[model samples]
Target: MIDPSAPLPRPRSDLTEPPDVPQVLTGALRVLQGRLLLHVSPARVGYFRPQLDAGRSGLVLCGPNALQQARKLRGAEQFGGPLLVDPAVYEVRAASGDEPFPNACEDTFAFDDPLAVSLAEQRAVGVTAPMSPTGYLHAEDSEALKAAVRQVAALDDPQVVFAAPVDVGWLREEDSVRQLIACLRLVPGPKALMLGGQMDPLARHPRSVDHLRRIVAEVPGAALLRTDLAAFGALAAGAAFTAFGAGSRLRHIVAPGEKAKTSKNFSTSPHVLFPELMHFFLGKTLADRFAGAAAPVCGCAVCEGVRALDSFASNAGDRQTRAAAHNVAVLMEWLRTLTALPSGRARQQWWHERCLAAVDRYPLLNAQLLQPNGFKVPPQLKRWALAAPADEAASARADANDYRRS
Candidate 1:
């Protein structure tokens, strides 16, 4: 499990910009292609770590506040894949002086340079980017933000990627996002990690979807973190690499001061991922559906013949954890299917067909269940079916070069 209270180490001198990125990190990205990674949280580590050792990849994303957890990764040499200690320095109300370090797990992060803390912590944890820490970029403070990014990208270490956690405004405003991309381009790196903040789990917004396509087009070695099922679309859109959060909290990064709604009754129920529909449904809901006469059976590894996903209905924490493990497996299985194709266009085309089939089933499932209001198609599912993949030859090349696992 991720130790949320992990602290960063003091500044060190070894990372004057390493000349080469280790093969391990590079290999993970190369192998990702149309496959996906997981942005894992603490409770689910037990479920995810085994998969990582068995050839799956995952990322342990932390913010300034998550340094305690970040610091601890030092002793764990091989953590499945890249472990990012994100200095989520961008603020929704920076002008108002409310929580300057929005990524803080607690209030431990001092006003001192969070980028520096991340650099030191990453070094301690064995991440190579001593010179280039992913910097915070705010348009209002263009010169300062760019300078910070330039400082990190200056050495252009092979392992140092230019990572940017986007603000919600950029997603809502297309021009702003374009401007953000232009800035990102200025301080170029071999790779760039794009972390989405305050967006839908599946990124239903057309503008947001358009922005992701553009980012993949414009940014070098573009990657995605904390994008939930949107990772599927990003991979389809040709992002070098992408991730889905293990649970709802990491699905859409909440703003510093935002208040998220909660439901105690269903709070502990696992939000099961139904691979066929490419939608998440409450455990109890799926259990109830399975109880019906004409309910569908999941054929994924998690629910192969003789075992039904209906076992996930209980509100028990352990049951929820088990259900979540199944969720990861279900999605991973779908991605495996997508990546099994020989080319990018083939995978994208296959993804679209699956999405269309998923969209068509929502109504069928509703009718079968005999409920007036049954499964409603997620706006993201609809969007996925309607959107075309990056089919141009140039796009295929870009995706191939950018998503190289090795």
Candidate 2:
């Protein structure tokens, strides 16, 4: 959420100089190989620093407050090289501590503001707009969309990543397509786009894949596209896909008890689903298919293991953090495998199967992790996942009334 009311941060146009993207990304890749992309809240920066030294490539600081704290981590004391700041403008005051004194110190910042144009003012390796159809899909939001693009175009960042279902900010696919076309006309050079979808294996829908393909075809500068591991087989026929990161909330099919429900930290929590549940939800056969496509990833450690699908799953724990880590690990393998294959149908087929195998094994591990007694999460996460029981009808009704009135 972008802070609509706070005085906009001063814009630095000097960043107008095109950043050395390839060089920066290459450096980033070297660090990310076999390293984790750790994310930390403003308060937990201390806890994650040690992990950074262990094998973290970088960290995404969630709010302004977090970013402020991260400023202290510069130089050798910090675990990773660069600390990314993701500022949400629509809500609370920046959780960031005191602002950076000299101003040139901020490393990475992800701005999600519809009204403020300065987000695009900062020159970055990339900039993107996340459009989705499910939640907040209001056509009236297009004005904000245009403003966002105008800012991005103004910045003229060479690399861009378009994220998600395009229909969320537009009236329909056609309108969204038109808007994207218009945007590309503004910033037509080198860029990348990634398609995102929340998978529900038990309740599969054709619309998911259809929408993904439609967007991929329409969105300009789209180099990489993504979908569920189950759907990757179909997507692989045409586009390359990167595995989803740590924001999968309500996407799990087989976690245990309260863990199955959505929570505040779903986007940030490091828990993994149980292996058994992942098997039932994603299936072992699928895992084999993906494993067969195993490719080398520059920054992930999960893909290094070469073993049977079941054995791999066994090694992955059941908590959400563990499951997500395993998924990334396997995705690394798929990437490496995909990159290694010769340009041939046979090579494509091999890569496809390997990805499927890895995908299938995730749900089972996620399921086992959700059990109340299974994986022990931090106190903050445990409280965050707490949900009111079904029996709390009176309290629910009261809360509903309060929400409606508010």
Candidate 3:
């Protein structure tokens, strides 16, 4: 619960007025290794500032029910000037009539409301497009969707990235894939796409590499591919820039099955995977595969001379938040490392070895936990429930042989 008694971070209005600062906040975002975009909530904003100040490249201000929080974020002191301020206003419900979004368009929250107007007025770098919940946008009333798209397009800024449906929904059914492909083609302007590794059960294993390879090849611009650190390395071997998601994993940090899931701030715990993910992604594991000379950059703190994952993981409510920060910090570190590498071969070598160490490490930990007389499974797993088993047919969806036979 928010502390009503606590003083507000800064006094700001909820009105759609002009911003105090307007200019593509930073010049090159060159300090960031690869393009780093953060999806921030009101509560987590404080934690994110350290990374932002460290060298984070981009920002996505996501406001769900807390409209006032969004206003405060825009007016926050650290980001007062020409920073790229992307606001995602979500709350639109299904309804009749062609307003700005589809009748059922969940994407139609309030991007055009006062906050949006304020950003525009300040010329505080802004994108008109709101981040639509990935899977929910599909059933959105077409009129509303189009109107939202048009509004985004009309903005002077570049195209607002829309998350890819397949990655978020894990669209494996043949028809679903077809529909998603069509949606991508319909997206306005030079749009960026997002894909997730875990979303596709086959992505992490050997089975779906070829399909993922094709998807990467087909998508245009530098699209955002949201996956775990390990899988991100796998994809980076094939392309230049990729966007991976970090914060989602925080949800699983302290499974009741692990212990009693803590009720404090998430930033304070170590239940989810640790700093190892970042070490491998940036320092050795995946970076080794890119034989090409020009590897892309990541934006976060770990690469900015902070090698200690334990430092960030030391305090947290659940391990998930710890993992989330570690993930962001490390990705930034990895990007910085990428920028420093002179040749593709060196980067590839770094990634390969790092992955080898990481791959070797995780199983050992799992083995120790599963030992005959080890600690009992935590209650959180039982309470929240173990992830449902993967679909029997999931593996088949990525069949290389399917394409060959056809």
Candidate 4:
């Protein structure tokens, strides 16, 4: 339990997957091989843990509510992969108009409740590494927000990353951004997760993109708790690590207490990332999108000969797992390429060239498909292509580095 009067704790300085100095922060940029992570939904944890173990793909993460499975995750394999749980406590904050998040356990207590910390500690008992609970921003630099960051940083574990979802709109506020950065300095490291923000990650907004880059570029190593593919763009903007949900459902996140946008897409089916387009497409839509066009072929283990969907069909009953596996295999391959680059600058340039190539492919692919209005470049991809040319990223930050499929 937090004693409001107690002094703040010192955090462990080592924040890498196995703990290493942050090149992105210290300007000692290196190709990050050991610094890798994958975020998966609680349901897909079983599938990703083995993949991470076999490929040694680094850490895996899930939400605070995933603690209930601690019993099942006991022993050598218990609690899964060199892992960390996101204490998404911000959902407990009250918001007007929006419906409450259905899965939040923190709604039972006040955001300032010391009882909240004890509850989180109890839940974190068997996990690989404990994270202190944090909540969403009710307002910029809200005292309650500051208190929550302090509370999480004060947790017994020194490896804790100060993870929180600030409304992306507030990022445009200079003072609030400064204050937020100061608050983040209190933790072992800063890692920004944009959920329930006023702007979409790919809206191509200049100010929000620059501000988001500032927040993430501060401590690039602690990016393991992300839920969207846009987080991949941060690497181009100078982040040290990357992780996203294993499926579409897990990749996009809404703010706490805010009503999540409902999609007609099936939650159980994997949303395959079309590497050339840098967009997630449902199976049938993907097949239809490239119907007559020469579709991209994935040579990943799950999709060796034919198209990914065809490969998934032949696999039969386990389509979800197969598609999900293929998506990850494709992503890991991309990471492997980026990691093998000699230095950070080389990776950024290579990534920019890759995004530029993908953005170029959209026009030809759309033309080939005979679509009346050709597909538009995903704004994040468009922005990233222009944003990631080494020194230029800081002046106009953008982050659209989705993994490739071909």
Candidate 5:
């Protein structure tokens, strides 16, 4: 059972079985990994009860509003794991459609005063240090953010420093990765990287993988938290751990100018994202496309009885729930595969071969994967790419045969 009072897990050199961090703010925690970290919000406190009942090992991420509520919960003392408070100051400034904070433009929550003191009180009650909601606007901004984190760390003496890098689209540039690494180095302890804003483009870009690989090479102990599901591959590149939110609408990071809105239209649809193909299709569309083919669209429980497009579109709430569950399950499976590999290079090779095999099974996806500047196999995967198509097919067949025999 997870003891709520226990210290947060520290980073280790060997990431063979990297810890699982699930953004359980919106959805349930299904992957049962010992010593997990759950991201929760006060508004969604009800959703976390089930996890507590299961006695899972992990900490709760208490959003600013949720902090008071967490302290008052019935079994708050019995719950295992420390509470990590998220000031969520960025949400106040974000265009999330919420009522703006009073004197919103003029008032700033400076770390040197209010934050430092509040964080100290929070730590007294088993809460981890509050993460600075910093953004990476320019070189100067990065330096300032690092200095602020360093100052706050000195005051709180936190086990880990949590910070966000806004405008992650800049990750495409190698210089941006280097600068980010430098900023992380300035922090006093293990760091968690939160990529603010919509990260779909960066997560899908092939070069972004190389950039992440470089980060792992430079800062092997950093954690990549609350990122897009597509970027889960970074675990193979050498990140200590990666996470995705369970909510269908929850994004890894919140950026300025990003707006939030609620709608009753909950029509849910499952879309399989082919990273190599750089494309996704609705469950129904994929089903139709493979009407007579032998390729598998998805093997999740929800996709089992789904025969037609209308079937998935019929129940919005149920479909959305299942889709969220499936996404987490898929990411967990991928992590398992990478963990079993002996080294980062081996994991990268395995990922490359798997992507190629996926392309071979779904020939219709060939066009997108073969386009100019589209899904170029990384240089490290060149050896595998050298094999003829026939050899690749034979190797895959042999592997299947070996598995069946075993």
Candidate 6:
């Protein structure tokens, strides 16, 4: 059982950046940072063994279906770290078309459920507080929010508290932030904030970022947990931590009542997530860009091994694993660079400079950068943008060198 009086998980060090705790698949764990968050489903519980054997520090987040399966298989006892239960209330609300607030325990997983209690007994389990589907947060919602909080508090013992997702826009309003803080106060243990909805809107909105920074400053203890690539920005802005799904599509929030379809193509492809451009490119695309040159596209062990074989494409599973590893590595490096800066303003300046440099190096990404829905390049980034024609050859050379050294 988690101690209610204990403080929330703080950044291990102020001098160091928060850890890149990627929510990865079982296979990708070997190449990711040792501190991980395993996104497990009931059907995939068998894959848990390898991760445990790797002796990595991690948390197991049981998906909705997996929670049910875990009860039947007694999977919680096998995990070495905290076991989290994702109530997946969003799915239930969506399917049932219920109002977002005043969620009933019968509609979602209860912390006091026999299986949940059992899991807590062996290893504390995280309780995901119910969230709203419409992404609305206001003073009026306090009563309902309190009800949801009471439900989790009623549990005999829960290791962590995950606040339900809220609209990103809410952060823009001081009243909304205060209302949320009120709700968070109801949670007695370590807490995390889940940002609901597609992050694209927030990524391109400077005001939202400013508001988010304020929220982080105000609540230094609560970690930000997002299900999108935008987590990079959140962390750079001072979020205690962030996480994203292993799969590319898992980067977006699924609305209530929305049904998710599994991809027919199970084979994964080699790809890289370019944070500067906020886009992903398949290995073939990168290969085309570097045609006659030896481009160090990725430096991860998996990518390096694949490059040695001179095969950019391979089995789907292998491709997915390699791509995930490469993405995690790149993200980790970026976080380190940002954290090493002297102050928040310096970090922002560095990010702006990087974004500008990326645009100059890859003119092809210009359209995406300028898109209305694309990343809102900060004023500094715009100021540093190319004032004249970019030197293609020079840019290519720099890119190659960058990859080679990565």
Go through the candidates in order and give each one's C-alpha lDDT: 0.56, 0.34, 0.37, 0.54, 0.45, 0.44
Flag the better candidate by TM-score, 2 or 5: 5
The sequence of per-residue lDDT tens digits that candidate 4 reaches over residues 1-406 is 1124333322335333312234342212122223456766556676655445334354444554455444355544554444555555555553222221112453456444533553465345554444444555544535655565556566534444445555654566666655655566565544545444422433524565556565555533445345554555565445655557675535544565566554455453456767667666666566656656656787765577575442332224777666776777777767677767754467668877888898888878777778855567767677667665536654443332332321
lDDT winner:
1
Q: What ranges in model 3 sit over 4 Å off?
A: 1-33, 53-56, 65-76, 80-135, 138-159, 163-213, 225-246, 249-273, 277-327, 341-356, 364-406
Checking candidate 4 for backbone clashes, the offending pairs are 73-78, 73-79, 90-135, 90-136, 233-399
Winner on lDDT (5 vs 6): 5
Candidate 2 residue-wise lDDT, 1-406, digit = tens: 2223322212235434322111122222233222223334555555334323333234544434543465455433543364444442212211111210112223434343331322343223121221111111123244444444454456554433222222222322444444544454354332233232223321233233333333333433332222233223322323322222233431222211122344433343343322222222222332433454442222335323443233322323543343445554544444445445543344336533443444443444435444333222222112112212223435778999999999
- Report the error of model 1 at residue 149, Å: 3.6
Query: What would the per-residue lDDT of candidate 1 be over residues 255-357, giving only the tens digit for each residue?
Result: 4466654435456467877766787878777777767654456665656654566677777767765676677767777677666675456767887788889
Cα lDDT of model 6 by residue, 1-406, tens digit: 1123323334347424432222221222223222224344445444333323232223334344645554444444544343344444444342111233324345445433432443343232222221122222322344444455555556523233444555455555555555565555455443455554443435533455545544554453344553544454444444444454444333444444444543333243455665445455555554444454444444543355345212344344555445555565555556556656754445545655675676564554434334333333433233333211124435767998999999
> How far out, in Å, is residue 146 in model 6?
4.1
Clashes of 4: 5
Candidate 3 lDDT, 1-406, residue by residue in tens: 1112322212226524322211121233222223445545556655555554344244444444334554454555535421222232212222122444323223445554532443343243223233333222333233333444445545544334443322233233333333333334344433344332222233333323333333433333323433335234433433323444334532111111123233244333432333342222222212222232222333244334433333333333443454455556655666566546543345444555555554455445445434432222222112112111123125545575688889
Query: Candidate 6, overall lDDT?
Result: 0.44
TM-score of each: 0.75, 0.43, 0.49, 0.74, 0.60, 0.57
Q: Provide backbone clash counts, one per model.
A: 13, 70, 43, 5, 7, 5
